[model samples]
Every structure is written in C-alpha cells, then in structure tokens.
Target: MESTMNAFPVLETERLILRKVMKTDAASMLTYLSDKDVMEYYGLEPFKTEEEALSEVAWYDEIFTEGTGIRWGITLKGLDKVIGTCGFLNMVKQHSRSQIGYELDKQYWGKGIAREAMEAVLRYGFYEMKLHRIEALIEPPNTASIKLVERNGFMREGLLRDYEFNGKTFDDLYMYSLLRRDYKGELS
Candidate 1:
C-alpha cells in the first residue's frame, strides 16, 4: 500500500511509536543531537543549542512537506518524549527508492531500541511506501549502525570513497541496501 500525502504516517511496533515530529519535540531531539557521541558518525557536528534543535525539527517538516522524505520521532509506547528519530530521505519516487537514517540517545544505545525502531521503518519503506529499494549510507567506522542494518537484512554493497562532505572534510561512506525482493524473501 502506497502512502498518501494527506496524513503524516504514524508507525507502531511492539514497544515504540514512530510519529510525526513536532515543534514540541525539539527539546527531546536536542538530547541526542547535542551529544558528540551520537553525532560522530552522523556527519554533522553536535548541535549546541535548542535553537539548532528547533531548526532541525523545521527541516524535518520541510522534507515531509516537500515530499522528499518523512522523519518520525521515536518514543516509547506509553510516553510522549522522543528518544530518537528515524526515517527515509532523498526519496526518488520514480526510482522507488530512498535512503534511511536514524539515531538514538546515548542513554538508549545498546538496548536494541534502535533495531526495533528500524524494523518498523523498514516495513514502512518497503510495504507502505512501495519502495523498490532502500539504502543506508553509513560511515565505515560506525560498527553499531552497520550491525543494525545488517541485522535488518541490508547488505553492504561497497564503500563510496569521499562521497560526502561532512562540513569540514570529505568522508567515505559504505553503501548498504535491501531490495524489495530480498526484504520479502528474507524478512517476510
């Protein structure tokens, strides 16, 4: 089923809620975006202010409005506080593809939260979005992210040498992808 533009999708898993990010979520977003450890492989420098976090929230809105992508604030099933964000970006409708990105608060790391959240997003990308392919561009040294995607059935295609400019310098990123067929065959 393809998603319509009318409503921002809210995804649910066993223990989490992936909902549209709102202005009110800025402070929660700041918790992780401001942490150097979380931002290390994220390409951008740590956000230093709530204003920056607010701007990040605005960007999330802009992307969804423009039909470029959608980002969901990750929260526990019973809580309103966002613990992280995950979603698709750089979506190309004609190609039926998009790149996925995600990050969690440092305190929540290694708890399998990211993985559970990611599995829900992957389902949305493949089934709801009707995407043919979903990709992840991860910094090579980010073993945690690598393992997350790998566990979700994405395969490391290869390294994209000097592929992105992370503000200060060009960085190498590994390209990981899962095709619809592969996702269905392995994960369905």
Candidate 2:
C-alpha cells in the first residue's frame, strides 16, 4: 500500500505553513537563494537570477512528479512570500526512508522558524508518510543545522568524508537520522 494519503500536503505549524513550491514563488525564493550568507554552507553558489530560481522551481516540480522527493515552500501565517524550502530528498518508498533538506532566509535566523517547520514535516514523514527512518545530511561546520536536527531527536550517525563537490571545492557532511520508533514528538 502507498504511504501518502495526499502526495502533496499542506502542513501547518503554529507560526508557519509548508505548502507546495510553485513557479510563482520564484521571487520569494530568490530572497534567500541569492543570499550568500544563507547559501554559505549549502554546497552551491548562490542563485544569480530569477531565471535560475525559476529553473529551480521547475526542478522541484519534476522531483515531485517522479516521486523522488517533495519540497515545501515555508511561509509565515499571514505572509505570501516564501522564507524557505524544506522537505524530503532521495526518497525510497520501498525502504520507507528519505533524506531531509532545507534552507531558510537569513533574515529569519535566530528565530525558531526552522525548528517549527522541521518538526511539522517530521510529523508528516513519520505519521502521515509512515516512514521508518528520516535522515539528514548536513555540512560538518554548520553548527546551527546540526543543533536543529539534534534538538528534534536525530542522532549523529557518522561523518561522510568528501561526500559532495560544491562547484568550487569538495565538502564533508555528517549523517544524522531519527527512526519512527525513536521519535518522541507529538504525532498528530
């Protein structure tokens, strides 16, 4: 049986809403995608133009259609602009696992927005999607991201050396994961 009740779901938290990423969200996405500070540890150069952002939206669309992943646009409750994107990647339905990824606007840093968004999605992954395990691949030096996952009950599995080639150089990342049985969050 398929795990998802709705292949695309609009997940909501107290302060944020995670919905599908649309082409119309390009401008909002560029607000962060083009920020070097936000992309510093993202393993890729900051997006240079709206065209690039549009292409990125298209890529996201394709991934959903292919069932490889689903990316959600994170927005504040009363705002129309997307402050970030978060969701599953490298999803393996048969194995009931997937890797989580996300990027938020620098302006929203220091707030608990990322944690709120991640917690909402994690619930969807474990309960709604019936996933056995959800993993995260984070650059070793990104302490904020590491803490974010750790705070949500993901355990550090190990380090993956030279795991990615980020255009200018290679990078190493830490692997973290949370199993459904190990998750302690409210599973609504």
Candidate 3:
C-alpha cells in the first residue's frame, strides 16, 4: 500500500480537529474501540488488545494515501490526546459514495461530540472529496446513533435485512444518506 498523506489531510472544525490516526493514538484509542458498548452496533467483536487497535489504525494509514478512504482521529482543539475515531470507510470512488462510521469513548457520549465530528466528516466528504453521497448504516437497536444521523440531515433510506458483520448475521441495518442536493439546502 502507498502512503495516503496527500489524499487525506487533517481537517479542522470549530472545537475539534479530525486528523489522521497515528501510532501514538493506539493506546488511547483502544480504550474506546475495545469497549463492549461501543462495539454493540459495530459488526466486529470488541478489540481485546492495543495491537488489534494499532492494526486497524495502520490500515487507515495506508488508506489515507491511496485516496480510497478517509479515517480520522477525532481530537479536541487544545489537546493532542485522542478521544475517538471517526471517518469514512469502504470508499467506492467510481460510485462516488462511501460508508461513514464513528465511535467515541463512553464519557464523550451525549455531549454532542459525535454530532460535531460527523458534521465535519460530512463537509470533508461532500465539499472536499466531491462525493455524490455519504451514508451511515446502523443497527436498528442503536437508537442514539440512529438519532444522531437523522439530526445531521441524512435521510433514513430504508432497512437492509441481514447485513453481515464478523461472520455473524445481522437482522437489519437502517440506511441513511445525504446527497449533494440535500446538503446544498441543509448545510447553510
């Protein structure tokens, strides 16, 4: 894999900075991704070790340079310490779309940090990447995530039955999307 430093650069927001995931972040990031609650909606099992988290972030490092995906570390404005991971996954360049995913440490939930980070990723996807659409597929039971996506103007497209994750069958995934036209009127 080639370096993605040029394809994905650091993106800044009002109170946060969405930057590339770094090796140093693995220790802090594992705390969140390894939590059971955080992985509840996610298809894969909770990460059991820092090496596992580091492996995932290393994948992001390669994707960043390839212009195939943009996975960012969600950090606060004043701190270099990472509190979460948020960004696009499974980027399909030819189709001009990708799946968006995010997860923060439990402590950061309900503080509107997820929403803020999402809005920023949307901007990067729509405006910077020139993508035609961005979407989120969440398990139906994850009500908070469902609400967060809706709050950001991503329409509830439909429920896809039996989405696969981690070799287990998922009953349904609520699909949400935001088109360029949809955002043109709503982003204001």
Clashes of 1: 0
Which lDDT tens digits does candidate 1 get at residues 1-188?
A: 24347799888888899999888888888989999999999989999998999998999988888888889999998898999999999998889999999999999999899999988888888877888999999989999999999999999999999999989999999999999988843243
Clashing residue pairs in all predictions, respectively, total 0, 0, 3
TM-score (C-alpha) between model 3 and the true structure: 0.91
Best by TM-score: 2
Pitting candidate 2 against candidate 3, the one with the higher lDDT is 2
Candidate 2 versus truth, CA RMSD in Å, comes to: 1.4
lDDT of 1 at 117: 91
Q: lDDT of model 2 at residue 19?
A: 93
Provide the lowest-lDDT 10-residue window in model 3.
1-10
Model 2 scores a TM of 0.95
Candidate 1's error at 110, in angstroms?
A: 0.9
Write candidate 3's Cα lDDT for 34-101 as tens digits: 89998887787899999998898889876666667778899998998789878887888878898898
**Alpha-carbon lDDT, every model:** 0.89, 0.89, 0.82
Q: Write the per-residue lDDT of candidate 2 for residues 1-188, one digit (tens) a residue.
A: 15333557899888998998888999989989999989998877999999999998998887777777888999999997899999988889999999999999999998999999999989888887788999999998899999999999999999999999999788999999999999998959
Model 1 quality (TM-score) = 0.95
**Stretches > 4 Å off in candidate 1:** 1-4, 184-188
Model 1: how far residue 94 lies from native, Å: 0.6
Ranking of all candidate structures by their TM-score, best first: 2, 1, 3
